[model samples]
Target: MRGVSLIILVIFFCGASSATAQFYQTTTAHVSFYSSAPVEDIEAVSTEGISVINADNGTISFKVKMRSFQFEKGLMQEHFNENYVESEIYPHATFKGEFLEKIDLQITGSQENTIKGTFTVHGVSKEREIPVILNVLDGGQRINLSANFQVACEAHKIKIPKILWKNIAEIIEVNVNADFQFISK
Candidate 1:
């Protein structure tokens, strides 16, 4: 519930207005990560991500529960929560920022934009500028956003044991896909 509340607070902080607000939101944003290593490849996906975008001003926020990620192997999932990310201490990863380019809510096609913001993971926050491909759909009533980025585990203080160094990659690939529907404030 804290995650949900945080998203709501983000929306309100965007200065939503009752008469002219243009908020698009969803609780099912898709977020995934991949790690390629010499010994093994690791991947996980979480469809339980929450996001809110103020289309009027291009304000955006995204949050995903760390434990919500599902891995193919039970052991990998356990290690992810208990070892890598330490889900008990840092329960969620979040991004908050605004689009660098002005948003055109009426655009019928796709647009390339860059979002600069702070990405928090494993209790560490880093400023990032990520490129995104956004498609306006349903006559501007829906927006689909996709982005791919890389993160260094060491930068976030996620340590890899010496024995497991070969099993995990130093850098991880992250992918985000989210579809948000326009909702009136």
Candidate 2:
């Protein structure tokens, strides 16, 4: 009976350890922003973003260097780093949030969900709930996420010159996409 008890205990411990949460992470996530006004259209893309998701708890977080964004015109990029986002002062923009509903991402396919969290830009943080689309691929070994949201310049104290106000939109459309492979511990 003692041997039987020891065997059951070993199985329980092994199962408990194996049931721990798993996470997926990627450093090459893509993030982009677009602003279209009557006078001008502006857009920038950044591939130097890092994203992580917990397959167990549905928690997600993303971070990107402000200077990593690239614009078609050099001047535009310079202006964005110096005058608007002030990359020198606040180097990175980050988002941290948790899923509102429970779902298993290990199953391959697409699922829509909402997440509530805080987004920090220009050193200011705002709580927002965003809708997201998750795509599972590679039979649960890979995952992709996409989210669309809007950010208001005024909300973060981003100042735009009066002359260029019309050239830039007060609200910017932000889009994010990230691909990740499951990391086993």
Candidate 3:
């Protein structure tokens, strides 16, 4: 009877360890965006983005502070926060979604996949399907993800003044690169 109880305990411990490995997260994900207008190009980047992924369920989430983005010119940043996105009112942008295909955590190397989810910006949420490249590195201890997508200013309620319309594009190109580490739940 003692031997049977010991076996059950070991199995329980093994199961628990594996379950904990399914969670991966990071707080320093890099996010950038660019807008090409007829007159000038606008760009900004934020390295304070936070993200998480559930390997067992293919669920993913990301949150980026609107005020954290840094632009080349201070005036550009000010205009972005005060007039465009209204960062004081809508402080953060978020994305929550799931991978359309199964992701094997044990797999090494890169895989192309699509994620479908809601992307909220400037207080507006829109459904988006983003294509991503997942690179599993260090024997699954780390995962690097890269994706490029476009967001429409009008769709997100970000208003570009007619006077400066030539300085801002209607559609913005966004890029994300995140490195996540496996964490125990």
TM-score of each: 0.94, 0.87, 0.88
Q: List the residue pairs that clash in candidate 1.
A: none
* Overall local distance difference test of candidate 3: 0.84
**Best prediction by TM-score:** 1
Backbone clashes per model, in order? Answer: 0, 0, 0
Give all candidates' CA lDDT scores. Answer: 0.89, 0.82, 0.84
Candidate order by lDDT, decreasing, is 1, 3, 2
Which structure among the candidates has the greatest lDDT? 1
lDDT of 1 by residue, 53-157 (tens): 887777888889999999999999999999989999999999889999987877888999999998999999999999999999988899999999999999999
| Candidate 1 ranges beyond 4 A from true positions | 2-7, 11-13, 16-18
Candidate 2 ranges beyond 4 A from true positions: 1-19
Candidate 3 similarity to native, TM-score: 0.88
Error of 1 at 77 (Å): 0.5
Worst 10 residues of 1 by lDDT: 9-18
**Per-residue lDDT for 83-147 in model 3, tens only?**
99999999989888889998776789999999998899999999999999999989888999999
Better of 2 and 3 by lDDT: 3
